[model samples]
Target: MVNISEKDIQLLQEQVISLHKEAVEGNAKAVKDLHQLLERVRSDHSDIPLLDAYHGSTMILIARDKTNPLDKLRWSKSGLKLLDGAVSSAPQNIMVRLLRGKAAYKLPEKHFHRARTAIEDYTFLIKRQIHGEGFLNTKRYWQLIYELGEVYHRIGRNQDASICWLKLKNEAQDPSFLHLLQLKLKLLEGKPSVEYIPDAESPISNLIRRAANATESELNNRLKQQKK
Candidate 1:
């Protein structure tokens, strides 16, 4: 067995994070690269909770490239299983929780029925963030709150959703983000009579996506350096 040093593992993890950002942004080639990188990591560092969680995330991303419905579902299920195992093994790992939470929320509830799981993970992270226990900076922290509210609305918990959104509205400093929050609140008002379904292409969703992209500046720079 080849012995991998801690520095090697850290670099691998950093590469994973960089690739994950591209994967999220709809880079198909990045998906393949991320999958290969994660496979290499798994071969070297079995049972590392962070690696498992990231590999699981890559599996879920790979599902998007599958042409067959059955294949997509199979990949998603397998990915989620790995994510669940990671969380169960390292419940205190906030990064694992956030990755699983995002995965659960992104999945369609009718098929995966992971809405509650998403809510649980987000809520757990939110509580920790409230206590300054997590690593999320201000923008990502409020972004998590926004995402949590969306999950709440998914499950018809309007009041809870409102609370989350309103809390962000009160403290968030970005003008554009605050404007979107106002628009979202208005949309939420009419949600009681209609089921709240999130549209990925919606303006608010795009804003959040942009915010996420902005937050990864450091990771993006590291990726560029790695390429050269």
Candidate 2:
């Protein structure tokens, strides 16, 4: 395996972060510009499969815009193919796996098989954590746990989801994350069975909605207090 320098990794991370911001804001031109930057990096470092994966994932993000549905589908499929090839070539590369897992998680229900691929990646990371080989005691670790919990809930494994959130709640010190876990747990508690119905919205979505509503209410209350 070709080794990437720390400086190179840092530069790539910064570029990816900027790309993510542009993608989230739906800036197609900025995303294209970022892709060009990545292409330059890829040309300079042709051995880095990670850059290929990033470029592919960025294309997927660009496809999320409300444009031609058929073109969007084509781009998404192309991205997934690139990701799959990268991962297949480097099965143990955590960075590539993370990219693929995140991309898979956002796919529609018609792509449940692809979603399962994300679940597999998350499961592998958790297993690595158990053996002290993966990230521990870090925000990234907790975020993975949270995402794994959401995946479990999405797939109707309520019990597993509850366990993941409970573990997170026990270990979490951050007030906001703890509150979110508590909300997740609360939503799970009233269910009669461990199996969540596929037709219903997942508890995670409810948690998000509840959190948003709480934030809005709090902001309104603060405004009222200011007026008083």
TM-score for each candidate, following the candidate numbering: 0.79, 0.70
Model 1 per-residue lDDT tens digits across residues 93-186: 9999999998887775545667789988988998898897858887778877887787677667788888888998999877877777787788
**Model 2 pairs whose backbones collide:** none
Candidate 1: clashing pairs of residues: none
Q: Where in model 1 is the C-alpha error above 4 Å?
A: 190-228
lDDT of each: 0.77, 0.69
lDDT for position 57 in model 1: 89
Tens digits of per-residue lDDT, candidate 2, 82-145, equal 8888888888887788888877766543332454777888787777877888555577787778
**Candidate 2 accuracy as lDDT:** 0.69
* Range of the 10 consecutive residues with the lowest summed lDDT in candidate 2: 207-216
> After aligning candidate 1 to the native by TM-score, how far in Å is the CA of 23 from where it should be?
1.5
